[model samples]
Target: MFYDVRRIESYSLKISIENGRVEKVKFDESRGKAFRVLKNGFWGYFVGDVDDREGIYLAEKNAIGKGDVNVLNVSSGGKFTLKPKEDFRDVSVEEKVEFLRDVEKNLKGDKIVSTSVTYFENVRRFSYYDSNGNEVFYEIPRIGLIVSAVAKDRTLQFYSKRIMKPAGLEALKGAYDIANEVVDVVTKLVNANAPPSGDMNVVADSSLAGVFIHEAFGHAVEGDHVLQGASVLANKLGQKVADESVNIYDDPTLREFGFYPFDDEGVKAEKRTIVENGILKDFLHSRETALKFNSKAGNSRAEGLKFPIVRMSNTYLDRGQYKFDELLEIAKDGVYLVGSRGGETNPATGYFQFNAQYGYLIEGGELTEMIRDVSLSGYTLEILKNIKIGCELEFDPGFCGKVDQLVPVSDGSPHILIKALVGGS
Candidate 1:
């Protein structure tokens, strides 16, 4: 095993528009350095970064430490190349603002009293080096579009969604529709009634399905939590954990939100099956954690300048043969939940809570009435087992938070029929 020193420089533009007016514009540039040392067992780690070359050397020298050091022998070392459909560098900032303004304008509706649109683009360049005389350089471009709509009435409701991908200007092509969707949902909720809390089967739309995977399953598989003995999955390998129809994966090689050619540890990224047909196929692992279990899967990632830890990229459930209507056919007296605002998970306890932007009540297998203020809470294993059916796959982009840091991620599946224990918390 060998150690590598890597540096990354990122440039980003964040533009926000509210109520059909440009509210703020900001540009940010930052550089980060990381040192990868392989000496002791999996327990040894010391990482810190500074801007100057002198500080880089100081950080490297200080990276040395005692205890177990986990070293992974990667097949190759380099950065992944990104091909943008539309280059942000080739587009002017004026065009970006105009695009968002257009979206806000279209969001006007009787119930939608206010609308906000946010546009973000970033270029991340990586320079990598290793003790084995290897060096590489590459850049990845990312873009995101988010819109939020609020209903004005005696009762207030808000709806929002985010789009993330590797494309540039063309990425905003569907942003207009996102605004419309938010408006449509919020409009319904503005006059909708509260959902009756119960343990009913729910049909989660693609976005909410993504949240179910990210918050309910992704958090449960993080290797660090397992290493800290804080994960329910810590010692449950090769066990049956879900229904026979369920399978989940994390593949950064996918050109979606969480796509990365190489992980922060200079290891090439690949797809790994975390669960298959209710079986615990594997757990996400960093080099250190992988060594601890004598495994070879690589899922290590570092946020900006932090030390590498296990994280998921493009984490999602595989598609099933059933169509969405089939799920509706089964959830006749349940709820059709859509989109996600945010959620939380306790990997150690296997508990999760996710909030839905809006929902529609289903009666006798037909859409009935709109409902608001819906949140789902339950244990991860129980929910997974309760997944009776899922439609063909779909995807949604998002940012995942961990250890006080956020990283780009995407998750999705078709409408899933989960006999979830939901409530209005």
Candidate 2:
């Protein structure tokens, strides 16, 4: 039998600027502890604000029944912390709001009708102890800025830009640049033509590619999904699943938004290579899932007191050999999709559909004209097998949600060229 306890503290601030004025400001703080015990093959979990010993006793008492389970006989402990060069806690709320107001001031264009800027920061600290003589502590801070611009000509057009990172208040320094880019993008989108509808070669920028790999393929490889037969890759291990030029990895040790030294289960975080040179490799796993599959453990995560589950950290397509320009030349005539709005996927069926925030028509190996309301859809495996990976990998930071639990994550890829179904207005 084993017992574990976790203490968590989080602080966040959000400021919204609309139409060159401060619209809203909010701040939040929370702290709590969660206790868990594994006994007789049954897991018991409880959350409370009581003495640690009492909580552990209650959790152990609740752990009843028996089943087949095995945990690695490993013991580790550590303390890790990242101190922001410019700590957000040291900055006053008024100053942060003022900074956002200045950013909104730059999001102005003759055709621009409305602009909204949002600034957010989060700091989280965690401490953990388990019956196996493992102890750990860590703290991380994250910040993000988003700018949305709306333009009105004959019709209304909208565009947005986001800059998020696992850093301190310093990350907000780019808000002005992001705001300007959003203004320019929305202004051009006001006159952009509708994309053509049909199957065609497509070039995805790093951001779109990141979202593509994360949504279209990443979720399908989670260990829990594989165990439940909910993933297409369930029985495809050691088989070819992608082009020879493609490789994919999920690494929690990367200093990105999803970075973590140790998972909720006190397992040391490490990289998992899901695909290597077109071959299916492994699935992301929790301790239990790893034990079930006779694999290694690392990726267990939870939302506060919720039970830990297999989750992704920094998942990305490994960089290939072709340069961005080379990929464009290879694509010749295709749609060049830029950023992602959002998307949906059926991991069980390997089907995905993602909407591009905006894009451009590629003609004669050059970007010809901007296009709007474009969507890309295809079978995930098919796209992977047909992809032409590129050099110059880049990452984009965001939050990934699974089973109603949201966790910070980063996804990345270089430019990729592939053939898929394209839908337009």
Candidate 3:
């Protein structure tokens, strides 16, 4: 029998503020243990409501079946902690409330009609052990604040910004700036017009470009999807799938929201270059998939007390030498899409549609009137070939959801000029 046990614990605090008043304050602490067993080559899992031996017994009972699930022999373990300076625990709740108030006041505007801000901080500790005698443990503290604002004049528009990092109060140093930017963007978006619709040159700002990379290309390279015949890139490994100017990487070592010293399965993090100079090189993997693909394993991850799955951490498109003006010049008569609301993609078909938070029209290679409710869409394989990567890669943090599980992640890219179909949503 092959089995693993996990003990996960967390402490978190959240405060919600609206229109400069505290709306809610919440604090929570939780802990749980889960067990996974492979009996007769079938995997089974059980979480909560049992002591260690009982949990293992139940898991093994469920795992008893005629099946074929094999895992590579990997003996890996470690202990680490990402300690945050000025821990949120040391900061009083009143002070946290006051901090939110100061940030709320930064959302200044005559046209602004509403504002809401939420603060969150969490400390997570995890322990893992397996029948093979491997053990691992780690602790990490994280914090974040989200601010949203709505404005109305000719049209109602909304905008939001968030700052999440693997730190404590110090992570919110730029909260005021984000608040101001949200107000400023939404204020202008109220008067913004719909974009011109067509297949044309489009320049995606870093945030939007990052979204495309994460949502379209990144998902296509997940090992499980590839193995399941659910990815377009599955058969394209070692071949050119993008322009020679492009390079894409998934690295969890960065100190972004997705940072982790090691994944849940005890595999140490490493930079995996999925695409290099246009060729598809590697796919993200868990140990199970790694054996099938003959690739290194590091991306096995999971929500607390959940079974590990293949996942991405900090994924980004490598920067090119082109500047913002150069990308604008390249897309002389198209929309300059900025930010991301959200998007959906079909990895099997490589088709994706994403909504840009807002954008501007480019005429004669210069920014013109603001445009709202813009969307970009295209086949991933084709779109990658059509992009001209720009300089100064930047990251935007958020949660990536799959199969009802969500994990913190960061996506990044420089500006990218591409030809795509753009329209109003």
Candidate 4:
């Protein structure tokens, strides 16, 4: 048998604060060892927590007979570079904590009944090799700061707009913007009222619209789901999916949370268009799925130590021809939904549910009353076709969860004016 080896390691630190007291601090490191041994087109895989060279080799040899030895048909991978401005390895935990503490203190306000803040930092290093002599190596650092706020009512709440980014400590510097947004939303919620129910022309803020595209449309474009006959977009390539002004992309090549030199499968990632000028372009794919569907692998990925799966990195809508105010100017009576509290979707059924932190009634093309508990639910295909206009673009960062696994992702679009259906009690 011939074997190929890969090296993987992760360093992580987390600090949580609540009620002006230090809550918890966690530090850990993980090193993974894996061997790819091939015999007669069959692959024998072995993975463990040990890093000793001898242990890794022995584990590969010993596991040859335990599981199904099926060789994975993979694509050719080559050298690539994803440079970091500052590496997390050069920073200390105490330094990270001090920055987070400052954020907590800065956000403390009279209307802020309580505050909880969390800081997370991680660095991943890995290298992989193939029998074909292809090699890929990567070093990436990520940082996250999340602040949760409660108003005097205790029930009125919201979360920070800042999410983890694929950068170093410098990424955490401008977090006061997020903290201020959270404070504003929570305070408004304490005094806001529910929007009156009606058929409405709506403007979805960039962050909320980004979540709409990701949870509602992006997942529908993963090739695996299409192959499984579980996606609403299945077999819809070359057809119109939205307004001619709508152009959505999954571009890992762009600088965002999902950027990577190469996917976990060691394949070079590429920018892909899922929708262009209202037409369906293509679906995201891994090598196997791409082969099965006669397409290119768009670098759909998963975490290390696990086999790679089809996933989106930085999915976003391209900016449109209109500005945000212009969209509102066209709608005399409507509501504008802003920000997001995440959302849920069934890509197969095209059904989705998304909650906005707050909304404002627009009267005479001007912002008016504030509304609370705004949730939008509908079929993905139906609502997308109803998009009247697209606004300029912006990004909202967060973690995307799939099958209980969390991966960093960013979603955004400019404000979108839509004739949408929303419901709440």
Candidate 5:
């Protein structure tokens, strides 16, 4: 028999300004606990706002059914408290509003008809203790700023930029540059031409390529998906999956938005190599999945009071030897896509489709004109094999959704050259 208890206490704030007007400023607090028990090859789970002993009793009582669920035994214990250089509470709401205004001012333009800015800061305190002598706790802050604008001429176009990190107020130091970038993209988008159709060579910026790998490939490597036979990579471990030049990693230790000292399961975090030079190496795993697969455990994570599940933290394609100019040169006559608006991917089928926020047409190894409504789609494995990676990797932070739970994550890569179908949507 085994048991564990997890609890989370959090405080968060959100402030937003719209079209040069202060719109909403809100604060929130939440706390919850979860209990889990394993007995007779069955597991029981309960989440609530109850005391430790009562929670454990409820969980054990709920473990009345029979199932073949077992968790790996690992001993891990630690405590981490990240002290922000400047505490978020030290900044007044008025000061935050003014700071947001400073960023919004840069979004002004004749073609720009709408603008908005939102700031978020949250601190979560997690505590965990389990039967295997695993115990851990952490207090970390997550901060983000979002700036966006919409431009209209003969057509409507939208652009947005986000700066998020595991730091405190200091992360907003780049507010000026972020707002300027939002304005620049929206400005060009107003006069940009529609994207060309059909399959063609393509160059992807770090942000776009990051999303590609995270959505198309990351989910497919979660151990649960492999066990369920829902991923195309279910049986491809130790086999070649990408070109020898391609290497991918997911690390929770990075100071990006998804930084976590220890996963919810009390596993000490480490960088996990999913693909190493074309070879499928490992999958993200929760304790149960790890035991079944006879693999190591650590990728398990949970939102407040939710069931622990396999998740990616800061996933990225490791940088390669080529430079940005080299990728453009290799793509000679293709679209250079920058940023990602949104998209869809089927991990079971190894296919994906994504909409670029905007792109520029590449003519004769050089950028020609900005293009709007840009999209790229292809088979994930095919693109992975053909990827010509660039030097200087970077990351884009956002939330990832799985089974109705949203967790912070960052996807990143250097520029890349590949071939795929481009469309205007």
Candidate 6:
């Protein structure tokens, strides 16, 4: 039997400013412990208040038997701490609220119906011990600022800017510039025409490309999805999945919002190249899934005491040779999609659809007119095969949800050119 104990200590603060006024300020602190026992092929888990001894007892008592499976050996253990330039705890709630309020002030315009600014920070401490003589501890801190502007004329238009990273309050130092950009984009979107609906070459900004990589391609390469036969990439390792310029990696070591020195499963966090030069290389893996796939374990993650599962960290498409202007020129007659509201993907079928918050028509290698209500839809493999990757890489931080669990993650890419179906209202 194998057993492990995990303790998570978390602190968070949030400030919301709406319409140039402080709307809400909240702070929370929580501590929890989870214990897991591996018996036969079954996992017995228990989560409760931060009492490690009790959690261990309960987890052992709950052990069950299925068949048998062996996990890859990962015995390295140590203590790691991330020292932020500025500690988030040192910044008072009032200061955070005031900063957001100032950012909100810069987002006001006559056509703007409402503006909201939110600042959030989280610090998490993780400690782990296992029966195999392994112990580890680490601390991670993250902060983010989100600014939203809604403009109303004949209809409503909204635009938002997000700045999230694995830093402290210093990450929000440039909040005003992002606020101004959001206001300008929303103002233009308020009067922009709907894009023409059809299939065409398209250029995606870094943010949209990030979401596309995360939702379209990333999930399909998850080992858990492959085990369940719910991924198109299952059984397709070493095959060509994208253009040779396409290189993708999920690196937990990167100092992005998804940075983690060690996974919850006591596995040392390391970078996994999921795709390299268009060939399917590897899948993200937890201990169990790693065992099943005869691979190494590292991608396992959890939120507080929730059960650990395979999850992506800082996933991104590697930068290519083409610059942003070069990509636009390559897509000479297509639309330039910018920013992502949200999107959905079916890992099994590789079908994906995502909305670009706003876009611009490209004419003669230049951005021509603003467009709104645009959605991009296509099969993941098809888009990847048609992709022309760009040189400037950028990352966007957010939360990823799977199996009812939410975890911080960062996804990124440079400008990418592709041909896909574009839908417009």
TM-score: which candidate is best? 5
Error of 5 at 1 (Å): 1.4
lDDT of 2 by residue, 236-267 (tens): 99999999988999999998888998998888
Root-mean-square deviation (CA) per prediction: 2.3, 1.4, 1.2, 3.2, 0.9, 1.3
Candidate 3 lDDT over 154-189, as tens digits, reads: 999989999999887888889989998998899999
Model 1 Cα lDDT, one tens digit per residue, 207-254: 888888887778778777778888887777889889888899888988
User: Least lDDT summed over 10 consecutive residues: which range in candidate 2?
Assistant: 67-76
Order of models, best TM-score first: 5, 3, 6, 2, 1, 4
Evaluate all candidate structures by whole-model CA lDDT and list the values in order. Answer: 0.79, 0.88, 0.91, 0.77, 0.92, 0.88
Which regions in candidate 4 have their CA more than 4 angstroms from the true location? 1-5, 35-45, 49-87
Please state the error at residue 213 of candidate 4 in Å.
0.7
Candidate 3 residue runs with Cα over 4 Å from true position: none
User: Which model, 1 or 4, shows the larger TM-score?
Assistant: 1
TM-score of 3: 0.98
- Candidate 5 residue spans exceeding 4 A from truth: none
Q: Which residue pairs clash within candidate 5? A: none
Cα TM-score per model: 0.93, 0.97, 0.98, 0.90, 0.99, 0.97
Model 6: ten consecutive residues of lowest lDDT: 64-73
Model 2: how far is 372 from its true place, Å? Answer: 0.3
True-structure lDDT of candidate 1:
0.79
**How are the candidates ranked when ordered by lDDT, highest leading?**
5, 3, 6, 2, 1, 4
Which structure among the candidates has the greatest lDDT?
Answer: 5
Put down candidate 6 lDDT per residue, 121-145, tens digits, no spaces: 8889999999888899998888998
The C-alpha stretches of model 1 lying farther than 4 A from their native spots are 38-57, 63-65
